[model samples]
Target: MSLASLSEAIEQDPVVTRELLHEVARRSGFTVAPRHEAAYLLGLRSSYAIAKQVDLLPDYVDPRLSIVPTLGGSRKYSKPEPDRNGLSAWCHFLNLQAVKTETRLLENRSIALKDTIAVGYIPQTLGTLPHFISSKTEYPHSQIDATVVRRLLLAGATLKGTSICENFSLSPMSYTSIFGPVHNPWQRGFNSGGSSSGSAALVALRAARKAGIKGLDDLGPDVELAIGGDQAGSIRVPAAYCGITA
Candidate 1:
């Protein structure tokens, strides 16, 4: 009896055709099988099921998310190769520095009030700037007055200006201490979009709304909250996917 008949008699089930091709390929070390033919046979049912599933699935109809903060005459934070040293300082320092520079520029009127609210991993030389936001279980430095903590506090204060209402709050986000994947509000399994992951999550989940945006004057200390930009599609992609519009 043929091998096929013998197997049918023993198992009482038909074998996948691709398995036979795979076995031939393995023994011959190479075979003249048709390109993607095996895949076509194996995935035929799954492909049809997927097509029907897509037909049944609902269509996505929503306005695309936009880049907020309006960093006029400036490029958004799209880093190609960010500095290594920048990471250790908890990226917050860079953010603080950028805002400070912008404040200084504003004082000089070098850039218009409506200039783009620059934020990136590495601070730009002139047109753009960078910032960081970090959250940790235990303070890295023993003394709170240490450089890192001091910088964070200083940046916070600097971002918070004279007006009481203008002052924005900076909150802790993802840290290694927390453990597990960052909580992406849109899709729980995915990243929340950190190191400012929590901040973006808040906006995405509508846990906290934009509240209001008047202009540069209205911008608060929480720069991270004001705009979302991470190297790996942190802001734009999630904002687009989640249908966040603000």
Candidate 2:
């Protein structure tokens, strides 16, 4: 390309061009002839060019929706009221299972997903306040179910809902969610534990239920298992704190 064209491209992608050029300069301190400088530099722009439409997601995502897409979720699934969610363990509530599933191994078992996993038409709070508090114009939600979510539903597991997680699933502590802290089932006000704190908390509470343990009866509906997004000590730490396996 001409020098004028190269200059124009760098202007359009100033940040990327500058960073890449800086790195190149730092690594290769050797000097080059001025006549070949423009040609040498032109190659670097390939990484940032907008060559074509970038929508690469699957054209057709199978319907792993909230029973009905338009209505957030079916009547059977819903957001838990404040009183019902005293433990602050759930992001939302639902009873999703494949109607004509091939397997029934997990039948009657209730599971919760960490809010980070995608569940079509359900609000993906990520335990942060986007539309949940500030922006009513749009509520952050997903339009397709993650692979594991689909598999679980197909396996006849009754999905209880998405559980609240550390904000953006980053922190290794339970108190980071925007809504509130997830209380320990064994003792309220105590730590429930990490990024997957809600998931572990719910499952631990449910485990305690069958063992004849008491004190966590009304926190929310019981969950037998949870699909957590573990990055750091999200899963294991919470499990350790709650005296259960993740």
Candidate 3:
């Protein structure tokens, strides 16, 4: 749509207009004196007009190609449950129900994804600094799976859920995220090294369950595999800290 059309739509919302004006004034250091109010409004309008035009620009992609071509068929999944411990291991537990396919290589295996990786229809945060469950202004769900995720599904891995990660997958420790720190699986107050902290924790939990450890009954079934991203020591650190094989 044109700038004028967008501006007209915006002007219809009196509350929005007032809020925008207040924000503009605050950000401008309140330098817009009464004598310059008209000029300030005009400038704000022009800026908004330009922003609207920019927003309308189409995002072009080659229609002839796909990032990862789908396999002959799609695999089904079961709904995933959140971690019981305050490990903050998961961002969102997905609900996908599917029967196992016997012919696939990874048939019956369950997998948890790091939040940095995209999963179709699930929400991804990559551990945003100031995290919110959803964004009002953006598309609500991921439209496609990451290539790794798609490959896993094709090989018959069941996507159980998405795990938490360091903010933007940059931190070496898990403490600096909106979901809070991922605790060491063995020690409650100890740090779980990031940004693959959750993945390691989940694996450790699964191992604990397999070992018939008491007091870990709430951790659900054993996860056969976990997918995590690494830069520096994200994957290895957490794995060592949690006493699990990465």
Candidate 4:
């Protein structure tokens, strides 16, 4: 039944409401205080508790089950490597984005000791770099790429502000200067688009399936977009290189 209808029914029956809250608490993995009454207000509280509880599962365990594409990258080749190494790098970045986003979300709720996995090197690199979580991450012993991503994502969501993911580019020389160059997937002669080179290539090959563009909007039939365009070669460059329309 719809939540509204269920709520009305709950308000009308005290005995039923008490029983229901007891049952819900047991099933929802929460400990209800003895002093807490099983009233409509408590029931409403339980609903959100249930949501947050369930939300933790997918964030921790399931990479495929995502409401949002929390990661991005490209599909071009830079140097010779084994078995499309650049492509793999791209996939790692995408995977970590989702993981990081989830992590951020969880931490914002102050859920203690939530497990986070780093998507790939990015999380690890960032952890080692100057960041807030790194200090709490035990100075290199406790950092997991996937875990860090999940933690970061969870944190990013709770701040009462616009949530946005933007596109930025860096050339081969530039990227390498920042975070070493990635190996190529195809041939050595080909150039994986720089900046998000690895991620773009992965999305094109279906190795990574995530919307590069993300924004909050209240619309029916949720938007499923893979990439966004801003300036020259922001998204369209990857889209065209990958042979995708959007």
Candidate with best TM-score:
2
lDDT of 1 by residue, 174-229 (tens): 32212223344434455433333423443444432344322312111222223433
- Highest lDDT: give the candidate number: 2
TM-score of each: 0.22, 0.76, 0.62, 0.28
Q: RMSD, model 3, all Cα superposed?
A: 7.8
In order of lDDT, best first, we have 2, 3, 4, 1
Which candidate order results from sorting by TM-score in descending order?
A: 2, 3, 4, 1
Q: Model 3, 1-246: lDDT tens per residue?
A: 765776675555344364567687799787556677656666666666666677888875443222333333443333344545455676666433333333487776888888878676556777774335454643245556667776676677766787878877888887876678877656567887888878888788777667776776665443667888877988988888888888
Error of 3 at 193 (Å): 1.2
lDDT of model 3 at residue 100?
A: 35
Model 1 local distance difference test score: 0.31
- After TM-score superposition, the amount by which residue 212's alpha carbon in candidate 3 deviates from its true location, in angstroms, is 3.8
lDDT for position 69 in model 4: 34
Q: So what's the TM-score on candidate 1?
A: 0.22
Q: lDDT of model 2 at residue 3?
A: 55
What's the residue-level lDDT of 160 in candidate 4? 13
Alpha carbon lDDT at 45, candidate 4:
55
Give the distance in Å from residue 143's predicted Cα in candidate 4 to where it truly belongs: 14
Q: Candidate 2's residue-wise lDDT over 82-201, tens digit each?
A: 888878898889877776666898888899999988877677778887864346654566767788877887778888898989887778878999878998887789998889988988
True-structure Cα RMSD, model 4: 19.3
